[model samples]
Structure formats: structure tokens, C-alpha cells
Target: MIPDLSHDRIDRLRDAFRAAGYDADGVVELLGPEAHVALGRGEPVPALRATTDAGPLGTLVRLFLLGQAEPQAAVEAALAPLPLTDAQAAGIVVADGDRLRAGLDVRPHGVGDDSWWVVSDLDSDLRGGRPVEPDHVLGVGHASLSLVRATSRRPVGSVLDLGTGCGVQALHASTHAQRITATDVSKRALALAEATFRLNEIDVELTEGEWFDPVRGRRFDMVVCNPPFVVGPPRTDFTYRDSGLAGDDASALVVRQLPAFLNEGGTGQLLASWVHREGEDWEDRVSRWLPPGAGVDAWFVQRDVADPALYVGTWLRDAGYDLRSPQGVQKAGEWLDWFEDNGVVGIGFGFVTLRRTDAARGEVVCEDLRHAFDDPLGPESDQWLRRVDWLRANASAEGLLAARLVTADSTVLEQVSEPGDEGWSPLVHRLHRTDGPGWQHEVDELGVRLLAGCRGALPLGELLELLAMGFGEDAEELTRAAVPVVRELVRHGMLVPAEWAGGAQ
Candidate 1:
């Protein structure tokens, strides 16, 4: 059962937690570095040892975080401002064989000084190593953190957190959005989300329904979802990771239906997985899932791809199944049989960003981004959307030639030289971005010369003519060769339009 936040002691509970130093920093100080990291990895032994006989803070930590029972008096002392009876009434704690234990998993979650508590159902380990219930409300995990890091936090008029499990996305949305509405298909998950928002004192509208059902016919400026995007046979074993729709259709459904729920210029960010079939491009397969002629610009970045066997193994372990057990073997065989019956060969996991536009045709760009990043993707994604829009507008030869271009400040030109008999000679030149996704492009002599002349001082057409004269080449031939290269550079933010560079930078 979820905690009841409507009780009168809710404010007192928050105050007691703060007074007991039960925040992120406080927990870190109590557990030290090693135990804290272990606890984060779902290992509780070190944390259990550290919290034993520690203090009111330690008692509270053991009870709520480590899934241990605390003596009645110790729990009472930790929650002093609020009575133990009231906590029990609110379903925050329950009697456990002469001791008290936390009924809900409450822990501090936030960055830096912004400390907020997240309340959700206990994990599988705490629940005696069983698969999660069908209506389980998941807490913070890797997928949620990925979405948080990738979501654009620009201030918006309205925001929607679709399938907001335990409200992690909605919590982040509250920082930048004026009106926040969160929806979940499960009522149990919604209850936990409501308690989380109440304890944190953030005003959010909670709705119950599947997908966009609760907020139908309404458009928001921004939408974020870390939906049940697992690509496999459709099953409702766990609500958090299974959408009850057949093989990758869950992700497809969300993508195809996004345009109708977004305002003009609205953006949707989601984590999705798509099937990779043999002899067919994954890009073409996913592109088919998008709405045709819907004016939705899309950019998909595939981060990882797993073969069928590895995919099945990973998800089986994720569902708290021991792979060596008989049940696991049987389940894996059945899942693989289903996969073989279909054309499934591999599964690709990644981030998908879509923007609604008023233009007639929208651009679709897909690429594999396996390289590590130096910075968070939030700003990088926003800049990419802007760059794509610019590229779409000046797509034709005439429009590009008339446009003045500037090299980005983060652009770095690297040249590799090899020693020759006489001296060192340049072998290859690569242009790399130092700040964003660390994208690098190999450039030829003509490409290097073109980039050198693009300082936002003259139109690209003039720069091409000047380079053609220097190389003793025809200007028309040089233009024909350089336009495509320039478009690629502009699309990746290596070069920016002179007029639009100021705000974008």
C-alpha cells in the first residue's frame, strides 16, 4: 500500500526528516563513501553494518533504506515531532514482531542542495526476492536518470510526464515548467506519486489512465516519458517495463501518437527500443513507425545494440529470475522460440527526440552515438533541434550559398602528421566538437579550406569562389563539391549560420 499523504502529520513528518538530517548529504555522511556506493548498487550488507547502533539518523536509515526493522523507541525518537501512531496510520511504518519497519521505501533524491524524498514500493530484494508485482511502482533507476540527463529543461508553459512511475520525471519537470501534469496507467503507482509530490510540496496534477488517455485533446509545450519500451513479446508480468503490446509496438504506438498531443513547436523526449532484423536497416524499420506527413521532426540516437541471446539473459535477470534455475531455462526457451518465429535478430536501445512543426515536410535523422560524452545531453539536444530546423530552411543550393556561416567555438581541427624522408607531412585532418557528443568528421583539403574561410564575414558562395581561385579550380565545380560537405558540417553544429549563431551559442 502507498503512503497516505493527506494525513495531518505529513508536514510534521517532513520536518522530522529534515531535523534528523535524513537528506542526501546526511545519508552520505552517515554511510561514508564505500557503503554509500554499495547501497546504490543494491548491496545492503555494508550499509546495514554501518547503521547498526549509530543514532536516530542511523535508525531511520536502517528502517527506510536498508529494509531493516528498528526498535520501537528508536523509531519514535527518530520521528519525534510526529507520533509513531500517526506514522502507522499514514501507512509509513508497520509493526514487525515487536519492532517497526518502513511500509514504503522513502529516500532522499535530488542534485546538490535541492533535496527531495522519493517514496515508492520496495524493490525485489527487500520483498524476499520475488518478481515485482504487476502494479509495482518503481523508484529511481538507470533509465530514469538517463531521461533526466537528456531532457531539455528550458522553461515551458505546460509539461506532461507520461507513465510517470513514482514521479521522477515529474519532479524534474517541476523545476522548469509552470503547469505540470503527470499520468500513470496503474492507480497504485499514481498513489505513490501523489505522496511523493505532497511530501516535497510541489503542486502537480495527478491523472490516471493509459498513455495519453487522461489528457486527451490537450497539447503541452513539452513531454517526457521513460515508458515500458522493452522490445520483446508483449506481456503484463510487470507494468513498469512491459506495455502489453506486441514486440516494440509499445514504443511505436507512443511515437506515432505523439504529434496529435503536442502543440505547434512542442517537443517530446523518450527512451525507446526497436527491433533490428537481418538484412534490413534499423533506421528504415523505425522510420516506418513515425506518422507520415505529420510535420514531426525526429532524431534518434542508438546507444547500444544487443543480440537476441544477450537481450533475453539481461531481461531475465532484471525480472529477478536466476538464469540457472529450471523456470529461467524454460522461460528463456519460450521467449527465444517466439523471437525465432518472428524476424527478431537484435534490439537497439536509445533516445528519441521529436518536435512538432508548422512546416510541410519535417526532417528525420538517425545515427549511432556510441562515443562517450563530455557534457550532459540536455543542452546538446536543444542545440541539435535548432540546427536541424536551420538546415531544413536553407536546404536548397541557392539558399545555402546566400547564407553566411560561422564555425562553432567548440569546433577543433586536428591534423595527424607522419614523418617522411624530407619532413613531416599531413596525413589526415579531422574536425571534432569538444563540448557536445564529441562527434568527429574526417575532412579533405577542400573541406579544410572551406571551414577556414567560414568566419561569419562572407556568404558561403563568396568563400567557395575564393577557395576555387586559390586551388585553380572551376568555381561551379567547387560549389557542387562543397555544398554537401557544408551541409553535413552545419547539421552537426561544426558550422552555424551567422544570423542564428548568437542565440544558439
Candidate 2:
């Protein structure tokens, strides 16, 4: 049953949740650290045992997280202002012979200091440990969190939350965007999202359609999507994960159409999966999704790549299909057969950020960055796009060497040496990044010297000249050798142009 969104009832429900401490911290405290961690992993026994007592917070956790029925009196005690009858009327809970059980999963979600309660359909773990429904509305999951962490949080006049299942991204965007528009193809998901917004006391324009169909001819300053980009043969079992498009076409469609919906200088951030064919380069395949004259700069980070079997098993298990079971085996065979027929070598999953820039030629950068990053990659993403633009604009050796450069603050030099019979000599030099995507670049001695000398005091050419004289090498030869390395450093954001560093004219 979908939640009812009466304003007064939602207000009381919010007050009740607050008064009962039904939030992230409250849940953690109620279930000790061990149980809290266990619950996150879908092992609910510890949490169930911990919350056996009929305290308000305990009762709330049992009813929602554990999918257990609580006595009507206990529920009333937990949410006094919002009566049990009102909860039933709102479809949040169902009456079961003097007891009430949650009709949906409603739990507190926290982002930093701000807290919100998200409501969605019960997941398989909370629903008698079975597979999810066909049209399930998912709560916050890993992909959703990835999109949130990757999204740029700079203030924008408008934002479009595409495929906003349960409205988590839209809720986050409300903090930074002036006007928020959330769209989804599933009406049930939309209803859950609407309830989420009302419970959180936020206003968002809701639309119904696939992709950008609802917002045709309109543009937004920012577009955030955690779309249904799962790659597989068409299936009707899941709406939240599978788009029913053949292979990776759903993701391709989204990428192909995104540029038209973004306003000039607008950013479109998405979590997507693309197919890797047997003979084609994955980078080239993904880059081909962007039209030649789209005027959009793309930065794609391939975080995970799975072969056919692994990908099939992962999604099947995610949908709660046990591979050992007969039905699970049959479905897996079907998926593998589809991949074989389609010549799918692997499936790459990643985040794609597109910025509508004014450049006449579009740039697409695809990198395999399967590494951990510090939280809140928004600023880092913005800076990276700027750096890519700068690199593209100054692609020539002359232009690059003429610009004053400085080593990025996030970089540190590390010299690795091997002990030998004669003496210790540096074998490899590494530029380690302490923050912002955490890149480690192996550099030569000359590159190290140039980076060390680039304190924003001189143009790169002059620095190379000084280094050549110090080493008794030809200046022209040194410049020729260092130009490509400098360009590479600039592309990776290890070196910043002086204008970007704000240290020189």
C-alpha cells in the first residue's frame, strides 16, 4: 500500500519520528555498534534480538527494519501524536488483529548533520527474506549513495532528478537548488517519493514519464540521475533496476539524449553501465555515445567491470534469486545466453558527468578509476572538468610551456629506492595524491625536478631551462622531453596552470 500524503498527518508523523528518535543515530544507539553494522549487511538477527524490548525506538525498529508486528498499544506509544488509526489510514502500517506491522520501509537516513526519513517498498531482506517485487521502489542503496557522493553541490537555479526512485537525490538537491523537479516512470515510486517529500517538508515538482519525456524542450541547470542502467536481456521482473531495454541500450539512450536537456554550462551527472564488446575499446565505445558536435564535455570513470557470469550472478542475487535454485539457474542461463548472442565481453559500471560547455569541439575522457576517494567528490569533479577544459584549450607544447604551472596541493612526492650491494639509488618516483580521487603517478627524475620547481613563480619553459642548465643538458632537448609529461600532469590535475592556481597573472 502506498502512503497517504495528508499535510496535517505528515506533520504529526514527522513530529512523532523526531520525538521518538527514529533516526540514524537513534537506530545505532538502540542497536549497539555490532548489531548496527550487522543490520546494514542484512543480518538482522542481532538487531532483532537487541530491539526485542517494546521501547518506542525498539518498537519502531522492529516494526520497520525487522518487519515485525507490534501491538497497537506499543505503536501508539511510539507515535503518540500520530495515532495508530492515522498511521493505518496513511497506509504506513497495516492492522493485524490488534497488532500493526509496517506496510513499507520507513527509516531515518542521514547525510552529514542533516537527517531525513525515507519511505519505500520493503526490500527482500525485510520481507520474509524473499525476492523483491516486480515494481519495487527502492530505498537508499549503494548506487544512490554513489550518485549523491559524485554529484556537484554548487548552488543552482534549477535541478532535475531523473528517475528519482523514492526521491533521495531530489531531497539532497533541495538543499542546494532553488527549484527541484523529480521525475520517474513508475507511479508507485513517485507516490513513495511524494510521501518522502511531504514527510520531510520539502517542495518538488513531480513529473511522470520515461527519461526526459516529461521535460521536453526544457532545460535545467543541473540534472542528476541514478537511472535503471542494469545491462541484461529484457525482463519484466524488476522496474527499479532493469529498464526493459535490450542489452545496454537503456544506458546508451540516456547518455545520447542528456545533452539536449542540459542548459548551457549545466551539468548532468549519472550512474550508468555500458557494454564492452569483444573487439572494441571500452573507452571508444563509451565516447561514441556522445555526438561529435554535442558541445558537452564528458568525464567518465569506470569503477567496476564484470564479465558475463559475474555480472549475471550479481544482478540475480541482487534481485534475490539464489543461483543454486532451479529458477535462478534458468534465469542466469538466459542472461548468459543473451550476453553470448550479443558478443558482450564485459559490462563496465561507472559515474558519468557531462557539462554543457561552449567549446566547439566536444571532449570525452574515459578512465578506469577503481579506487577509493575521500567523501564529497563534488568539488573535485568541478575542478577536474575545469582542468580538462584547460588542457584541451592548451593542447600544444608551446601553449602549455608558456603557461605558468604549480604542483597541486593534494600531491606529494615519494621516492622509492632498493637497497643494493653498491648503494641505495632511487628506483621509482611517485606523486601520491592525499585527496581528490587519490591518484598515484610514477614520474621520472626530470619530471620530479620540474614538479618540485613549479612553485607558481615561473613559466614551465623557464623551469625546464633552469633544470636543463643545472643538469648540463640541452635546453631544447629537455623541453621536448618534458612537454608531454607536463601535459599529462595537467590532464590528471597533478599540475595546475598559474591562472587556475590564482598565484600569477
Candidate 3:
């Protein structure tokens, strides 16, 4: 079950900690049970002085949890070359060109297995989310892997993960494709990913560059990116969230180049944000992001949109900036200027699924998918793969037509019970219904049983036969029932008849 959460409590606690004086580099020592007890009992923590200051330190913690980039260890590593201030437990370490270190060490510092974290000290800098440090946020965790599967149909030859922050998508892509490449701007972020790869024992090629600079002319079977899509100016101390680009053009530039970098039969899946201007529709603005005549099949999912002012303030708070503060006011002003100058009133955030035409085949699909994505309706890709393998073994339509079939438990045998009858009536021809209570024949214990045995292989028919031989049933009737499921699977392209190489099919 998902955790019951209260962003409200988080907000109050964040403010309290900053009022208590904390730095943003993952320090949360001030937020022990004592702090919670005060809030729980409506008692105030005496340690935190009442102040009008917006807590930049506490806000940094919030941004990290939201998966923004941060140099978790750079300030510490540069310690000898820079001056240090007491922050959290050990102290705050910072590096400006003139200097290199200022931070809060919430506890006694220690290192584990070549990894660095301020241990023994409290973690006030972590915001409220301690375990979910931003440097290691990307992974095959629940949402990241779900993203990998939903992005496209698989068995791809190669895939590329651009702005591959935590290397989460790239790691998962290894299971679906032969080769994978991941690129990012920060070496610290890349280092965390490298550690992740070492821990998981998954091999992936890693490179460093801004956007597509390092990957000049490379093409891939797929491209995946979770770009910096926040459409606002950075807090005085900027890290991963702000890429210093105006409006949504940062995301736009990366997507525009996809056609040139996509191999034949490749798809680019991007989790991005775009800006919407007052005079034009948001959809048209994004539709224009695609290069002219590139003919890429694009599916954009708009989950959230916020007006410029609100968007700016939200990010400011995220980075622990107080809009009323002098620096905060200036930063917010700059964002408003950029937004208005670009004719952008609101910012649109969504995912972009692009399937580039197989240029080698001279095919092109230039259009938009206004239809909803992420809602699973059709047969899954694995089910489709099974159908393909079945066809490879039995090429002719006659072979499949004459085959005996058996049913499985997951194979529901739907039949109307007559008023006086006990068991359900078996169904024959395929029936169509929107809710899909299609006719199901009698299920064989063996057919339903064999699914566990076949792993993920074999289409419905081949598995049915194993059941037929295991338990005697009329082969033809079972085959008849199986045929419709197969065809339906084929119609949905979950299964294809033995055929084309390339995109010909």
C-alpha cells in the first residue's frame, strides 16, 4: 500500500527547521521526534526562533526529494581547497570560484564502502525525505521501471537515455535491448549511477555532455529523457532543477533533434515540460516542436499545467527561497520576464512518446496522438510476442486452423446458466462487447496449469494442446475457441502472422 502522506506537515516542519537555522545539503538533525511532538501536541519548539526569513536550506531538501540535481559530495570533496562553516552536524561546506566549502554536518562524519554521507549526525538537510536523496533518485524503483515498460513495445536493438540523471531508465532498458547509453551533465550524478550499476551488476555505457552535444550524430533504437522541465529561474543557489534556459525551449531543443538521432524503427520516450502562450493553443506549440517532414509518431500526455507566476513561486519554495526576500523577488521577477517575453502564460508538463519512421524503409508517420496514453486496454506486448513465436513454429494458416486446443483457468469459460441448470454453457464464436465478457469455453485444469510452466512463452493454442493431452477434451472445440483469441491478439498486433523483417509488417 502507498504511504499516507501530508505535504502540509512537511511544509510546516520545513519552515520550522529553517527558522531553527539549517543548511540545505541533506541536514535534518533538527527534525527528530521532539519536533514532531511539538507539532502533534500543538506545542511549539522553543529552539526555533520566530522569524520572517524564508528557509533556503530546508527548501533545498524538498527539491532533492522531487529528484532535482544536487552536488551531494562536491563541497565536502573540495574541503581542503575551501573554507568550511559549521552546519547541521559536521558543518556546511560550499565552493564558490573564490572559495570551495560551506555546509552543515548533522552528525559525526563517516564513509561506508567508498560511499560518502554525513553519518552519526542528524539529516535536517534531507528536508523530510531522508532515504530518497536526489543523487541516487533514479533507479528501477516502482515508478522508474513502470516508465520503462510503458514507453514503448520492446525487443529493441539499442536504446539511449539522455539526461540520464540516476541511470534508472538506462539500467532497465538493458533487459529489453542489446546495448544502452546514458548521458548527463553532472559527474556526481553520473558517479551515483555508476555505483548503482556496480551494485546491480548491470553494464551500461556512460558519457558526459550537455544534452546531445556528446552524441552528435548517433542513432538509437530508442531515446529516453527525463529533462529539467521546470520553467523558472533558479534560486540564488541553483543545482539540478534549473538548466538556465528560457521558457520550455530547453525541452524543445532536445526533442527537435530526435528525428536526426533515431535509427529506423526507433522510438524516443521523453518525460518533459513545455510552455503555453496566451494567444495559441498549448498542443499546437508542442506539435511544432517536431521538425518539419520528420514524420515521427508523437504521443504527449499533459498531466499538469500551471500559470507562470504560480509556477515561479512553487519552484522558489521548492528550492527553499522566500518570494518576499530580496533575492527571491528578483529571481521570481526574472522568470516572469522570461515567460512574458516568450509569450508564455502557463507551463505544460507531460511525457512525449515518439516513434520515428524507419527511414531505411522510406516510411513516415507525422501526426499527434490526442488519445490517452498509459491506460492499458489492448493485449500486452509480451502476449503479442508469444503469438509471434507460435507463428514461427506453425507457419501455415492450416497448421494453426487444424490444431487441437485446451483452456486454462485464467482462460475464463463464460456461459449463461439456464434457469434450472447448474454449470455454465460453453461459448463458441467470438463475441464482442465494450466491457468484454467474451464467451469462454470449459477450462482445462492442465491448460490453466501450464501457464506457470511455460514462463512467458507460447501463445494460447500451443499451451492448450499441453492441457488437451494432459486431460482428454474435444480438441477441435478447444481449437475453435483458441483461434478467436489468437486472431483478436493478432488484430491488436499482440501477435503477428509469420512475416516481415524491418517495418514491413
Candidate 4:
């Protein structure tokens, strides 16, 4: 049942939570370090034992976080101004004789300095430690954190959070956007999001519809979505992950439809999973999702790829299915069979960033970087898009030679040598980027000297000429050989235009 979120009740509830100090630090202090760590691993026994003392904070934690029934007097004491009857009326708790049990999961979620509480359906870990319900509304999870960290948080006039399950993304967007709209296909999810916003005292416009249907004619400066991009056969049960659409279609639809909803210079970021077909490259398959000549720029980073068996097992375990059980094995085999029949070679999971630009044609940059990186990649992502645009504008050899370049502060040049009979001779030269997704590229000796000479004061052509004189080679020939490598460096942010060294270009 959805909570009745009246203004007065919300105010009282906030006061109650604040009075009890039911926040991230407070919970950790009450549960201690071991219980907190155990809870993170989905083991709630330690937490339950830690909260056995019927204190106000402990009572609330047991009722909500541990999904345990607490005595009526304890619940009433925990929420002093907000009565237990009001909690029942709001559908957040149910009366179990002399005890009260939470109807939903409410927990403290904090990022940086911003802290707030999230409300959603009880997960499998809290509810008997088994598979979750079909229409479960997820609270804060890794996917939610990934989208939050991946999104570019530049201050914008308007922002949209699509498929906002419990409004975690919208909550984060509220920190930067002036006007925020959060939409979901499920009314229940929307209700929980409303409760979340009310708890946080944030004003976000809530809409209910599938994908872009809620805001058909409006455009936003930023649109962030963590939709149901999981690829598989039709499954109507899992609303949070399965979209019922056949095989990666949901992710494709989101990518294809982003251009129309974005304002010029606006950005759309999302987390998606795409299939790797046998005959086509995964990058090529994802690049085709952007329309030709749409004036949008796209950057896709594949973070993880898995075979069919691993993919099936991973998601099954996510849903709390024990893989060694008979039912779990049967379900896993069926999913694997489905993948085999559908010609799915592998599944790639990653972040996709699309920006509407003023260019005459669209540009797509696709890369497979299956590793982890530092969080809050917004600034880096925005810089990457600008770098790509700069490279595209200066693609020719003459244009590059005429442009002033600088080695990015995050770049490092490494020379690797092998010890042989003839002594240590350079075998490989690599340029590595320590920021964003952390890319590495192998370069030749000439390439290394050229990049080293890019100190933002000299034009690239002049640097190449000096290098040619030092090596007794033809300047024109060296420039021709180095142009493509320089372009690649610029595109990957190992090199940057002098104009963009300090500010936006």
C-alpha cells in the first residue's frame, strides 16, 4: 500500500526521524562496525542482535532496516510526535498484535555532504533472505550509485530523472538543477518517490508514464535515467530490471529517443546493457543506435562484459535465487538456452553519455573499458565531450599543426624496455591517462617526442619541425606520420587544445 503523504504528517515524520537521529552515522554508531559490515554483505543477524536493546534508534532500525516487529511502546517512543496510529494510516507500518512491523524499507542514504532517507519495498535480504517480489521498488543500490556518479552535475535550469524508482537520482539532481522532474512507469514507485521527496523537504515535480511519455513536448537541460536495460526474454514480473521488451530493445529505445528531449548543449546520461551479436562488433552495434545527422554526440564506455552463463547466474543471484538449488539451476538453464537461441554472444554493461550539439552531423565515440574508476565523473565526462568536439573540428593535418596543444595534466608517458643481450633497448612506449576511465595507448618514438614537446606555448607544427631537425628526418613526413596519433591523443583527452586548458571552450 502507498503511504498517505500529507504535509503535516510529513513534517512530523521528519521531526521524529531527526529527533531520534536516524541517519547514516547514527545507524553505524548504534550497530557498530561489525554489524554494519555484516549488513552490507546481506547478513542481518548481527544487526538484529546489535539492536536488541529496545532504545528509540534501535527500535526504528529493527522495525525498518531489519524488517523485524517491535513492541508498540517502543515504536511509539521512537516516533514521539508521530503516533503509531498515524504511521498505520500512512501505510508505513502494520499492527501485529502488540507489535508493529514496517511495511517498507526506510534507511539513511548520504553522499558527500547531502544526506537523506530513502523509502522503498523491503528487499530480499530483509524479507526472509530470498528472492524479491516481482514488483519490488528498489531503494539505494549500486546501479543507482553508478548513475549518480556517472551523471554530469553541471548546474542546469531544468533536469529530468526518467524511471526514477525511489527518486535517488532525482534527489541527487536536486543539488544542481533548478527545476527537477522525476517520472516512473509504476505508480507505486512514484508514491515511494513522493514520500522520499517529502522526507527530504525537496520540491520535485513527479509524473507517471513510461519513458518520455510524461513530458512529451518539454525539453530539459539534463536527462538522467537508469532504466530497465537488462536484456533477456520477456518477463512481466521484474518491473525494476526487465522491461518486457525483447533483448536489449529497451536500452536501444532510450538511446535512440534522447535527442528530441534534450535542449541544445544539454546532456543525457544513462546506464545500459547491450548484447554482442556474433557477426557484429559490440561497439558498432551500440553506435548504430544514434540516428545519422542528428546533431548529437555520444560516448559509450563498456565497464563489464559477461558470457551468457555468467550473465544469467549473476542476475539470478541478484534476485536472491540460490544457484545451487534445483529451481535455480532449472531457471538458469532456461535463461542460458534463451540466450543461445537468440544469438547473444555476450552482454556488455556500461555508461552511455549523449550530448546535443550544434554540429551538422552526429559523432559517436565507443570504447570498451572494463574496469573501475573514481566517482563523480561529471567534470571529466564534460571535458571528454569538449575534447572530442575539438578533435573533430581539427581533424586535418594542417589544422592540427596550426593548433597549440598541451599535454593533459592527467597524462603520463611510460617507456618500457626489455633486458636482452644487447642491453636495455626501448621495446614499447605508452601514453596513459590517470583520470576518468584511465586509458592507455602505445606510441612510437616520434610520437613520444611530439607529445612531450606539447607544453601549450608552441604550435604542434613547430614542435614537429624541431623534432625532425633533431632526428635528421623530413619535417613534412614526420608531421604526416604523427597527425593521426596526435588526433587520437586529443580525442582521448591525453592532449588538449590550449584554449580549453583552463576553462570551457
For every candidate in turn, the CA RMSD to the true structure comes to 2.1, 2.3, 13.9, 2.2
Q: Write the per-residue lDDT of candidate 4 for residues 63-90, one digit (tens) a residue.
A: 8888888888889898789877888898
lDDT by residue (tens digit), candidate 1, 144-203:
988898889899999999999899999998888999999999888888888888879999
TM-score between candidate 4 and the true structure: 0.94
Cα-based lDDT for every prediction: 0.87, 0.87, 0.50, 0.87
Q: Candidate 2 on 1-505: residue-level lDDT in tens?
A: 4467577887888898888889988998889999999988879899999998748889999998888888888999898798777888878888778788987889899988878899898887666668988889999889899889999988999999999999999989988999999999998999989889998989999999988999999999999999899998886678899888888778788888988888999999999999989788989888888866779899898988999999989888888888999999999999899999999999999989999988887778888888876655677788877777788788888888889888988789999999999999899999987877777889889889889999888988899999999989999999988888887777777888876675311
TM-score of every candidate relative to the true structure = 0.94, 0.94, 0.48, 0.94
Residues 212-264, candidate 3, lDDT per residue (tens digit)? 88788889888887776666543323434556676677778877887788886
* lDDT at position 287, candidate 2: 86
Runs of candidate 4 with Cα error greater than 4 angstroms are 29-35, 43-54, 95-98, 324-330, 502-505
lDDT pick, better of 2 and 3:
2
- Model 3 has an lDDT value of 0.50
Error of 4 at 437 (Å): 1.4
